[model samples]
Target: MPARSSSRLSPANSRIESMTVAACGGLATPAIETAIRIRLPASSASNTRFIKRSFEAVEPPLTLDEPGRMLMGMIVRPLRVYVSPVFRRIGLMLLAAVVTLASPALPAGGQDAPATPEVAVTDRVAPVWDGTYRRIRVPILMYHYVSPLPENADEYRRELTISPDTFRAHLEYLFFEGFTPISLYDLDEALLTGRELPAKPVVLTFDDGYIDHYTHVFPLLKQYGFTGTFFIITGRVDARDPNYVSWEQVGEMAAAGMDMEPHTKNHVSLQGRDYDFLVYEMLGSIESIKAHTGRQPHLFSYPVGQYDADTLAVARTLPIWRAVTTANGRYHTTDNRLEMPRVRITGGMSAPALASVLRGD
Candidate 1:
């Protein structure tokens, strides 16, 4: 493909060109004599000179030295030669085609290219960074399983899993206590732009993209008129793991205003990984989430809450705006965005316990 020219077509010219292109089917060569021509009335010399001067005043000069601007002359010259409407229309369309061919507006990648809209999710806005950071107390509650554990579940599973009842209690407390559930994207924007959040703003984030999130937590959140963010393991979804959320479920949640972000391709730790491995894991999950959600993820969750300097550097290089860790705290700042901390929601924790944790008691 030829390189696109840097010059921009004026809006008036662009509209005219577009209409002409539509009328002519974008064909450059046609039997001009056979084509319909509407003869324009002859203008007085004074009027013609005035019109020419007006055109010159509004339109920039075209020269061979600037190929990008040369196409304008082609369309303008036709108007001066004869008062035939067909010739002028054809010239306008040819100019449009020339400009389009010379500098296509389409991206280098085809239709399926990953596009990050201004807002990652609906009912949201892009964050504005004003070269400063603000400290705020917004508790980001992190969860794993919202379902009860099996008899054979090990200590690790026991530590992570929270019963559905306990999860409901947490939501109830949040709802009744006037805590507004927000996504990480909301927090990011609020902190960056000095935007005020609702009273008692709290973030609900689910890690690992578990099926329990879709089945148990999703409905409960909807019931309370709340929203949450889910960090997903793409490999598990791809492998059709019954325990993990399928791509269909992920899409459903994303469509319902859930903030779906990437954990990693295979839930790998970012602590000691090389650049190639980091890119593969990070981009793989990011692209997969983008494909399903139609919005590129701006947040990431570190597997096992482990990361080093390389992890932070790679995250900064990618589309990632902020990342959460297993570190315990509710006080978030713009300076520590990439290493934002969360309040770990442990198994068997009650609504009162959650309240206390949020209050830093």
Candidate 2:
């Protein structure tokens, strides 16, 4: 390749480059102001610099596409003058600048960055991000029981239970395909601090504290080295209900690093409940959970995915972080935190069906 031209950087381009550099270098605001005032008058980011140093930077034996693109870049550069972005957006602008600087010349396939070949790995979950989605799609997966159902089980039992074998396959598929399981707290912290989450994040949630959770789900979660959220019905806990788990099991799961959010005091639907009912369901659950687990529950799932507008309003009043609903869609950071949707996993959901769900299809 011939040496790049030594022409001076355009005043506009230079100012932009300087600002990007300054931001990355953690430069003082006064220096940036000095550059804006003295180094770059408002007029300088206009017509004169449009045939900017980018064109000059291009060597002469140009392709038919080069001049057109140069002209396009030059035109867009001036439009930045009219756009006054906030300071927070400056980091994003810096990223764009970095990309531009790093790959000034396109790769052989016309991509700015080299095309990475997909390498198959038996144990790795294949990454799926293509940088095209408008919103981050994370599937908050809901499960109830993960025990082997008998051949003569009832409809509700079958609908609410996933076979342990199928559950393990699901976990295997997730692990092989590279989905990172996270908790509601992780999502909350990310929303608050603008922290980046894994490219493919899937939250495993088991509703209604079942003995099967301690027997099958918890062990499977541990086997896969994954995390999950277990929603407990505080009234059923430690009451010797054969179906529901004990407080010792709940405490063990929490100590083992699983998230334990509240379901309700008695697992009642909150769709049209009064203020007193709502308080008992939400606050009562919190107090009961604290009494048993030594830590107050901070997140919740609506019992049977039932909640109305009034119930949601009451939920907002609770000290809990947020609540989840049974509506079937993926979770995005921008989605309503109070009414987040989840994909329910049930018996005999094939790997392909689960894959489609993960893909937000």
Candidate 3:
């Protein structure tokens, strides 16, 4: 007997035929023969109806001619007689391609994008400072005496004093914590050109020209290899004064790298004073310091941080470069050079507190 031909279809053969028709949009006799030879699985009649509806919605209607039209109709009639699963598979594949193309691109590293700069650990060791931002500022500390109190001297003790032990601890803390003691001249250079200071920078200043400042503080400063500024009251140097430093000591300090700037004649507040007295206080102190030390002091310290608009006006008129005030804050670029703020280091401040203040924390 001759070999019998199977009427039932298979899934694989149906998929191949459907893909060929979708790709070429036409069927020949050879294609139909090839599709029939590969046995395709039969799908449900409802599925065939759905696929036909979907195909008609997507594709333009075809017009038939004589021989090709007859062949196409015969092929589609068998496809409708036995439904095939190929159309559903093709739809799923096209849907997957669309979803993949529509999605957003992921980060190169296959993770969410970083929102901030990744600062390296090495950068933290030596921070590179650009001068654009006004974040950090130099701290200039002001002190007066280092003396233990006498039993019945409350008024004398409360003025401006720190014990020797406290002062030593403060210096040691600054030294160990990488602070470089800078002079007022160095500060002027930094202000003019935004230069990078040492890891830490601090300036030591003493006010009021007290005898104890020369007698006690100078020796300790010299021992520690540190320099400081001393603002002197010009008239009180040798005018029958037991409490103030003499002109001889002022000259000595000036010779030993310590600056001796003028702090007015009588240490009087310049706020409500007459213009003549202000001029006398301003110019007279400059003249007296020049006469004694042979070099005019270029800096000034306000008496008790008390100054008014007239005082600032007078300061602007003079050739003075900088002045110190007993203000309670860190020195910023916006600070007035004539009214520059100084952190007063007193008997109450500990080593850590002093360090914190110097670091502008």
The candidate scoring highest on TM-score is 1
RMSD of each: 18.8, 23.7, 38.8
CA lDDT of every candidate: 0.67, 0.61, 0.59
Estimate candidate 2's alpha-carbon lDDT, on a 0 to 1 scale: 0.61
TM-score of 3: 0.60
lDDT of 1 by residue, 46-69 (tens): 323312101111112211225534
Q: 349, model 2: CA deviation in Å?
A: 1.1
Q: Indicate the worst ten consecutive residues by lDDT in candidate 3.
A: 24-33
Write candidate 3's Cα lDDT for 1-361 as tens digits: 1122332333433332332221222111011122222233344333332221122212222223354445544444444343344353333233222221222222223343222221121101222333343423778898876666656757646656677788888888877788878877567656645566776788888888888888788887888888888888766663526788876688788778888888887688998664445655775576556545656567899998898776776565555777888887666552355667788876557898886777663
TM-score of each: 0.66, 0.61, 0.60
Q: Select the stronger candidate by TM-score from 1 and 3.
A: 1
Best by lDDT: 1
How far in Å is the alpha carbon of 31 misplaced in model 3? 99
* Cα misplacement distance, residue 135 of candidate 2 (Å): 4.8
Q: Which lDDT tens digits does candidate 2 get at residues 279-326?
A: 546655654455445564678899999987767655655556657889
